[model samples]
Target: MNYTYYGMFLWLPSVLSEKGYSLVHSLGYVLVMTLAQVPGYLTAAWLVERWGRKKTLVTAMILAAVAALLFGLANSTAMLIVCGLFLSYFMLAAFAGTYIFTVEQFPTVARATGMGWAAGFGRIGSALAPFITGWLLGVHLGYGWIFGLFFAILLVGFVIVVTLGYETRGKDIH
Candidate 1:
């Protein structure tokens, strides 16, 4: 998740520019995509309460994957913006749910440590994304290949959550 999310933030402007948009226009598009995060976070917050953490996260991941695929294939400006908005929304929503869910997975005594380690490991993914994205672009791999790779990663995350995650929606923290 962080892989794709961070990749987008680091490379979206470059991607846009490569598509022939000017620097200012690329930035504007990224800004519009980023603005979608607010509602995304809010929606996740609400869904976590209504649908629980695991479900919300899984839903976000799946939607994000689809958005990534579409964003890669988008040729027109309108499609690009719409796909970018969806990608940003679902990815940020997943982040919100993940933070809440990770904390819930640990008891009070180890919660901070668990969160810290989870975050630290997640940052590893974050750290790798930019370099990987840069390399892929440098190699002249198109958006299709780049985003297709992320699409697979997001699906792997979704599977991990479904198979390994437990519900913590209403249960009391230990």
Candidate 2:
């Protein structure tokens, strides 16, 4: 859930306007960032099998944090786009890993129930993020602040995944 808000809210064009990017360029960059997630998802699919769920998730979380931090502190448009691309990559990868791990946490009997609740509750974060971000942006908090908050939230997700996440790799799902 920690990441759900970020995934839903960090529409790069909207957020990058504060990064000193024009709407057109920001939109282009954001489009690239969004497209970049495909590789991350494919990577996660591979890593979840090769490296196992926990490692894949942890790696993605750390990378996501770094990317978000860089995006927040970036001064150049080039840097901003670079960081945003990586941020989306890792964030989506982490989300994919966590989602699979969550589904694997339960037996077949309860897998549907578990997924339902996880998805249901996860939407709360998604629903709330725009509002929170709107308020933050409206207050003239700056792009740094917006991205900084996302960085912090990503850390929270990292902690949660590292501390509480169980390895489901190689375990039978049936």
Candidate 3:
């Protein structure tokens, strides 16, 4: 989770530069994205309990993919900002739910270990994102392609969660 946001920090400046935006404007994009995290976290907490965790996670992943696609296709700064907010909301929500879901999927004895391994794997991807983004940008590929890639990743996640993840709508964890 931390690495995901951190990856964005590495790419924001370069992405803004590609769009010919000022540092202030670039920072605004980051700020908007960050601010969306608050509601996202809250929404995840509320909805995970109300809806099933699997359903919430799949929904969030789908929404994130949509937002990423929209941001990729955005022609104006305002559109990008709007998409950023949507992306942040879905990303944070899906991340929070994944943490809870993964822990719940394990027995009491192995829950911590399971969560730790899953989180570690997520961090690896996060760590690689900056290098990947930098390389893509170096090739002069547009932001559209970059975001499109993320959208594809999210889509795959959504499919996996829906098809393979167990439903824990009311499972008790001690």
Candidate with the greatest lDDT versus the true structure: 1
Model 3 weakest lDDT span, ten residues long: 1-10
Per-residue lDDT of model 2, residues 48-139, tens digit only: 98999889888998888888878878888788778878988888798878888888888899999989998887788787777787787789
Q: Which should have the higher lDDT, number 2 or number 3?
A: 3
Q: Pick the candidate with the highest TM-score.
A: 1
Residue 6 lDDT in model 3?
Answer: 50
**Candidate 3 lDDT over residue span 68-161, tens digit each:** 8788788998898888898889889988788777788878998889889988988888888888777877897777887788888788778887
**Which one wins by TM-score: 2 or 3?**
3
- lDDT of the structure predicted as candidate 1: 0.93
Tens-place lDDT per residue, model 1, 55-155, is 99999999999999999989999999999999999999999899898899899999999999989988999999999999999999899999998899999
Q: List the residue pairs that clash in candidate 1.
A: none
Model 2: pairs clashing at backbone N, Cα or C within 3 Å: none
By summed lDDT, which 10 consecutive residues of candidate 1 come out lowest?
A: 1-10
Q: Residue 22 in candidate 3 has what lDDT?
A: 86
